[model samples]
Structure formats: C-alpha cells, structure tokens
Target chain A: MDSITHAPSTEVLRAIVEAAADGVVLCDADGAVVLVNGAAREMVPGDVTSLLDRGREPGETYETTLGDRRLRVRREIFGIVHQAWYLRDVTQESARADALRAERERTQFLVEAGRRLSASLNTRRCARATAELATGLLADAAMVVLPPGGLRRTAWLRSSEAGLEEGEIPVAHADQVPGLAEALAGFPPVPSRWLDPHQAPEWLLPAGFGPVGHLLVTPLPGNGVPAGALVLARREGGAGFDDETETLVRVFAARAGAAISAAVLYQEQSATNTILAGDLRPPPLPVVDGLELAGSLRAAQQTALIGGDFYDVLPTPDGPLVTLGDVCGKGPRAAVLAGQVRHSLRALLLLERDPEQLMHLINKALLSSYTPRSHVTLVLAAIRPGDGVIDLAVAGHPAPLLLRADGVVEEVDARGTLLGAIRSGAITLRTASVDLAPGDLLLLYSDGITEAFGGPTGREMYGSVRLMTALATCAGMPATAVVERLEQLNSDWLAGGVFDDRALLAIRRSR
Target chain B: MDTAPFLIEIENPEPGTTRLTLSGDFDYTTSADLATMTPTLMSRGLSVLEVDLTGVTFIDSSGLATLIHLYDAAEEHPAEMRFVGMTPYIVHLFEVTALDQVFNLPTSAA
Candidate 1:
C-alpha cells in the first residue's frame, strides 16, 4: 500500500481528526486510550480510556449521552493496535424525531376520536361514546351533559374505579350542574380548578364519583348555541387541560354538539308539531248517552309528542264515529297526512254514513289529491249510542281487540285492502257488526302495539297473540284504564325503546 | 333512535337518462334532501329520469310523497321519469299504497 494512503503520519492523522466536526478517538486493541481529537476532548471531558471501552468495537453503532450532549457513537477496529471511534452530537436530531413521533401519535388519536364521535346518530349513544373516547386518553374522566331546559335532566353518567357507570344524578338547582351555565355562556373550554375534592358540587359527585383535581368544561355548540357540554376531569397530577389539548377536545365536543343539536331540534320541532297538529286531532270525544270513549296518541321515539298516529271521535247525526289511523311515516310530514286524513274523514262522514262507503271516498280523495299520496291504515267504528252496537270498517289496520264482561278476549274479523295499496276506485273493504253488552270494552290501535319488537328473547314480535293476552288482563276495566293497560304493556315489551308511533282508542259500554 | 343519513348520487347512465341513486332511510328529515335535488335534475332537460332505489334501505310516507312530487314534476317537464333497482320491500310498499298503478316501479321481488 502507498505509505501516505495506508498509514498517514501520526501528526497528519491528528490534524485530520482535529479538523473533523464529529468527535474522534483512537485506542489500542487492549482498549487503552491512545489519542483524542479536539471534538472528542470537548465531548468526553475526562476518563477517555473508559469511554474507549464503551466505544471500541468493529461494525457496532450505539447511542449514549455525555454530560449535556447526546451522541450517536460508532466504532471500528482500523488495525490490530488501532481502534477508531466516531461520535455525532445528535441532541437536536433526537428532539426532532421525538416531536415527529408525538405529532403522528396525536394525529392518529384525533382521527380515531373523530371517527368514533360521528359513528352514531343516536344522541345518547353518541354522548356516551364521546365521554368514553375522551377518558383514560385525553383525560382521567369525561361526562356528557345535556343542558336540559337549559338546566336539568334526569340521568347522568360518572367514571368510577369499576369503569364508567350510569345513574341518575339529581341536581336540585340549575347552578348545581357545574359548568352548564358557564358553557352556555359561550365561554368554552372553561378551565375549572378544584382545590379540594370535597368542595366539588354534590351533583358532580353523586355517591362515589371522581377524586378530580381539575376540570375543563367545553361547550358543544349546536347551530350557534350550546346544546350540551362535555366535562373533562383530570385527577391529581395533571397540569390542567392545556390550550393545545383543549383545542382537540373542543373539536371533538363540537362534532358531538352537532349531533346533539340535530336531536334537540328534532325534539323541539316534534313538541311544537304536537300542538300544531291539534287541527288534525279527532274532535273532542262527544258525551255519548250510554258509553265512554278515550284514546291516547304519542310518538314512538319518545322525542316527539305526536307523529303519524292519530285518533278522532266525531259526533254524527246517526251515532258516534270513531277513527284511529297510522300514516306510513312520522314527523311533520306524517302529521300533516294524519291531519288531512282525519279532517277528510270528518267531512266525508257528513256525505256518507256507511263506514265502508266513507273509506272508499277517503281512498279516492287520497289518490286524486295533488298532495303526495301516503298509505294509511285506519279502523273506523260507528258505534250507536245507547244501542250497544258498533259497526267497524278496517283498512289494512290491526284488528280491534274486544274484552267482554264475561272475561272473553276476541279479535274482530274485519279485514280490507290497505288504502293506497290499490287504486282509489279498486279498494275492497267490509264492515263487521259487533253486539256489545254492558261492561264490554273494544280497543282500536295502530300496528305499533302488535308489532312492537321485543320480549325476553328481544326478537319476538308483540304479535296479535300477546296483544290479545294482554288485553285479557284488562277485562272489566274502564275505557281509560284499558287504553292505559295496553300502553303500559307496549312500553314493557320494548326493553330499551320503541321504533313506531302508537295510537289507541277505546270504547266501553256502561249500563 | 337515530335516523340514518341520506346519500344522493347522480349518475348519467346514457346520453339522456339521468340516474339518481338514493340510499339510507328516507323519512321526514332526510326526504327533503332528495326532494331538493329533483328540480335541479328536472330542469337539466333530461329525456328520461330514473331513480335508482337499489341502495335505498327504507322509505316512509314523506319519502313516497317526495317520489310522487318528483313524478308530477317529470310529467310537467315532459321527461319520461321511471323507477328502477327497487328492493322487494319498496315494491311491496308501492303495492300496499296502490302507488304501483300511478308510478312505474320495479315489480320483481328482491
């Protein structure tokens, strides 16, 4: 080998090593200190031989720190007596790497959080999911607060040692629900300091709740105003919810807020619609000389008071005309259709006395009207006051259940083509006459009662069998009590909730 | 219960037929979205408008109403509007409401 290339002079090597920015060291095979460069001298202040022991090896690279400096150290045995070390001060690089890793983790977390938040449209489930996703990751605990009447509600959830548990947290006053008033005030991410856990509001600590040290109350603004708020609590040792983390939490809350807002609007509209749909309601139950009439109608979702289900009682020249119908859908549109059908039936009652003929006229009107055609199932009963006789006409509606004073439960055999299923002039219907004795009760209801999908198995339909069985239990009951019993049974059948509006009209004969 | 979100996809199958695909539950809140899209397609001057209900999972009174209104609009525009890719449930729904005689709907049960 050429002398200069193969083995430069010690002085030239020293000059080269000193000129390099990275720390360089040379040692003997025994790992004893032989020589050190300027950078090495600065990085390795003392005990250069011991540093050689850590660095001297062939094809080996590792990381270590020397005083305040982080170093990427590499070693190679240049010859039998010479071992060379290369040390790079990697402090800034390691910091950048750590920051990049942290950023990726945060991005991944936020994406997952956003996906989870928007996955469900159900307000309760979405609210609960918002709390779970924020807990043990974003904070120690999280709570979803529905600002009720801008004040109070019946149920709440709390994070405990056994995981998040649900219960009713009764708040006596509006101010007791911490962070609600403030959140609604538009001051979002309201950082609250809790110097003592005992001092926290009682509602915040039901029976056994958080040992929280701090809280960040963030308002979930739905359509500009705050519909609800998410309360994130950090147990002791947290430095409160910082602005950066608070921003992410607030964003999550905002997405949750939008869903809450939709539900809130739907509920509010349904309430107003119940009052507005009053025009579509059946005329007040006329005081029959020898009978009692009663009915109840409510939205299935519990969020709305009135929907597609409606009941009407009209006093005609001949007798008392009773109608209960369920339009094909719910909400304002269905309510409108229900109103139209009821009002039209009342108007048609004057022109035609036969229940079957009236149904034909109504069906024709529905098909020919410029308004969108909606399928409706109705049971029209023309009960002769003081005569104990009812003429029932069915149109794709559930059969009426009759409870006899003799304790026999029977279903009316009346059946007809569903209105709107056939052309207006082509509808086929039949009227059945039933003779009722004193203390007998007849129940007219929507399919929502018989089709309520639940039970012990949760998959079994509340078929006509169960409905008849349930009605048997209400034998000899008053008209109002009979309807209430059926409503209670329907509610009980649905373990969790209902998916259809229910309407029931009951008539009882009294001697 | 949460109402499913509505999806509206407008695809031109051929030169003159505009196919609008609807999916998710069509109820009071969401049927309006589909209704709002009909006039735009009607005014676009298509020869034949086909509503693809293959993706639609459920429809209610308002949804049917929206369809009826669309049919009415199609008639005034002189566009031959039709329905295709209907599920059996939808076919049954039309049959039950007697709307089968009014609007051209798919008959085969799916």
Candidate 2:
C-alpha cells in the first residue's frame, strides 16, 4: 500500500489537512515530522510527532491532559513510507464536568457547616467551629474574640505554626488588630471589608499571624448585645477574596454569630440563675431552749432575684434574740445591703442591748457607707426564754400581734423612727416588755403577705384585717403549722399566683 | 426605651419647701433620677424636701442607697427631707435595717 505513488499536489493536500477539525501530522520513516496542518499546529501539542517512531500499533489512541487542555492521539500507517498521527483537544468538555463537581461539594460544605455551628449551645465549642470554618473554606488562619463579661481579652485562633491556639492577650494590644477592635466594638457586619493587610497598623505586621496577605473581621451578632468577633487571614501572594468568596464567608459569619451569641446569652442566664438560687436558699432556723420557731419565704415569681427580706433567731448570752425585717426594695442589690445589715447586726448583738439604744449603734454603722434612700424597718425582740418575759422593740415597722392565752389578739404598742433616717440622733425605737404565758405565740412577717391581692377579679388586697382573721384560726397550732397557715392563706388569697417578696417567722413559747 | 419604671412629680407647695410625688416601680433604674433631682432641689436653697411615696409599688437597694447619699447632700445644703405617705408594711422596709432614724418619716399609728 504505497499511497505516495499517486499522491495529490501539495497545495490540494494542504487544503484538505488545514480544513479538517482534527489535527494532522505527517512524519518520515525515521519518525521526523515533515509536515503539520494548521489545525494540528493549533490543537495538538508539538511533541506528539515523536510517537510516530514508537511504532504504536495502528489505530491505537492515547489520552492525556496538558496544561489546561485534554488531548487524544491516534497513530496510523500512511502508504507504509510514513506514519501519521491525529490529536484532538477535549479541554472545554472536561472543564465543564469538573466545575459541576466542585459546585456540588461547596454546597455540601455549607450545609454541613450550618449544622455543626448550631449543634450545641456550649459557647467554646461553637466558637471553635467558627474558627475552623474560616480555615476550612477561605482563610489559612482565624481568630474569634469574645467581648468583655466573657473571656475579655482571650481569643480563639488557628494558624499554620500552631494547630489551634486560644491566646490571652492584653486588651491594650487591640490597637494593633484594627479589625478585632472594630469587631469587639460591634462595628463590622460585612466580611473581608478590611482586606488590605498592607494598610494594617505597623504594630500588627509582626503580630505572629505569619505574613498575612488579607484580613476579614466580622462581628458575632449578639441576640441583644454583640458577643464577640471573627477574624480570618490569608497568606501573602495568595489570591484575594472575590465577591463570591466574600458572600460565602458572610453567610457563615452570620450563622456563627447567631450561634455564639445564643450560647453566651445562655451562659449569662445560667450564672444569674445559680446566683439567684443560692441567694434564695434560706438558712436553717436554730433551736433554742423552751422555744420553737419556724420560718419560710416565697418570691414574687419565677426567676425573680433574691430579695432583701430576712429573719433570724439566735440564743445570746443575755437572752434569745428574735429579729425579722424587710430591707427597702428587692433583688440582688437589696440582698447585698440586707446581708451587710444582718452581719453588722449580728456583731452588734453582744456589745449592745436595749433595743432602742442598740438601734442607735446600728444606725451609726449603716451611716458609715451612705447609699441614698437606704432605710431598714425591723421588729427586734430579746426574750428571756422559759421565764416568759420578752422585750421587743420596733423601728418604724409594722406592729407585731400577740396571740394571748385567751381568745383575744392584741397589737404590741410599739413605735419608732426608721434606721439611718437621721445622721445624728438617739433613735426613738419603742421598746416594750411583755410577759408571755404558756401557749402564747408571736408572729413576724414581711409585707408581701398582707399586701398580696386577690379576689374573683384578682385586685382586692388580702389586707391586714384578713391576715388577723387568718391568724385567729391558728391559735392552738404549733409554730410550724402557723407558718404553713400563713403561706397557705397568702397563696389562697393570690389564687393563681404570687405577690412581692414574702417571709414569715413564727415563734411559740413552750408550755 | 420603654416608659420610666417610675414617675416623679415635683412641686413647691409652700415657701422654703419642695415636694416630690413618686409613683410606680422606684427600684434600681430610677435611683439615679432621684439622686440627680435631690441635689439640684437642695441646691435651690430650699429648707425642706417632702417626698410623697404613697403611689410607689416597689423599691430596691439602689433606691435606699440614693436616699442615704442624699443625707449628705441635705447636710451640705443645711436642708431636711421628710418622707411621707408610707404604708405600715413599707415602714417595716425601713426599720429592719434601722434606716428609720436616718430620714424623717410619718408616724405609724402602732
């Protein structure tokens, strides 16, 4: 088969080779390329002509990728004098398929990231995911900085040198990391807005972030208050983030922001709850000779802060002291003030006597630290246990009702000014001595009980008269039962709910 | 954002005296308002301040603290504050901590 014997003119042969879509190469018997068509010069790599000598079996095809193009080659014996090779480019077709695959993977990554971010309410875990997400997608390193009331200056970071680092830096260094400062200040919402790492503060250049080319700082949106920040960096000479990448990072930041804020909010609430629970837990009432005491307190509603209502009965050297009082207002602030009052009163107990005179000293002590509108109302009684003699003093407080041995209930004739109401004064707290007979009991309560209101419409106050009527029914009951009755009656008055802070302390003289 | 937790109404019922009527929840939040108002009121050369708290439903430690601090302001101005219209129970709020003697208060029938 010597086709060269009848070969057509070179011009016509060249026209046929140039018009073909596939590349055409003609080589000599020694495997040297003698002629190449226009299509062959454009589509096929120049080195493919060497395959003619390798003596590939006829009609054999080889496929490989070169640069951005995919190419296929075929060898054929032409008239036995020379071998011809054909090469075709498939770059565009393969590129379309590869792009489709990458798009699918990116979608999957976004879906999985959302799930991981919201998986747990634990703040640290969520924050860690946020840091990893940056490294997972766009940036080589990341940091998440939480606002104060949390880690303060501590931040979550991942870099090339250190796998993942939770670094605690000085707050003053925030000047170096401009984006971090802005994030902490709740300024940035757009991603990669501060991408020019070159323009970063001079101090930030050597920030151990390792030759950062670009930076993206964003705020973790606090549900109510911004919780912290997310900062990401890429190496120098790396491709700058394009619009699509910025959008992707923005979406991720939003999810992480919401998740982190939720966790931080939950942590704060849990802490507040722990403190509230501890503060509201009442201490055990102490037992004294020939005296029985019972006490209880109920908050206005669920999740209310610990209030400033308190009661205590202690056995002192002179006599047994019984005190119940309501500090002005409620909540943690009041609780702290009441705590100071209680401890100071405890210390003053041994040194001072005569309720009115003792109140004078207590007033002076309270004046030591002047807080506006601060005043204390209390019924303090020093009882000679078993002897049946009780000395009671009132400091601008509600009168204590005495359940006499008979069927009659009498109000203790007591009067006084409020504590610390005057800077310099001998307090006029009224002190009265009354002999307690067997079966006589004394009850002290915070106003939360009587002030409680309920009716069919829930607006009628229980009032002092109703409380007195309720007490008349508990005449012969034990001290514990009396306290229970007080609470039960108050609850019954409110019917479906509660009023302000309520406390009840009942002490009965043993027969 | 919301309405003030409490309201304070000021008036000059008589010469040499200033009166304030308070209503609503006067707790931690409104304490500063009262604190700021008192010093300015005292600095007006008034001899007495009369606060009517009949309408107040709640008060907190900050409220109390503000009052104690006002005592100094009153002294500096050589004026006096008389707190009135306290319910019997509210009177007890001022007594337990022995703050009753620090301010001039209404007499309890008891």
Query: Taking the candidates in order, what DockQ does each have?
Result: 0.14, 0.15
Native contact fraction, candidates in order: 0.17, 0.21
Residue-level lDDT of model 1, residues A96-200, one tens digit each, is 897788678678877887787667656677677777777776777677776565344545555534477665544344355566557755565554552233345
Worst 10 residues of 1 chain A by lDDT: A191-200
For candidate 2 chain A, the 10 contiguous residues with the lowest summed lDDT are: A199-208
lDDT at B89, model 1: 62
Residue B24 lDDT, candidate 2, scale 0-100: 72
Best by TM-score: 2
Taking the tens digit of each residue's C-alpha lDDT, what string does model 2 give over A409-428? 77777767666555664577
Predictions in order: lDDT = 0.73, 0.72
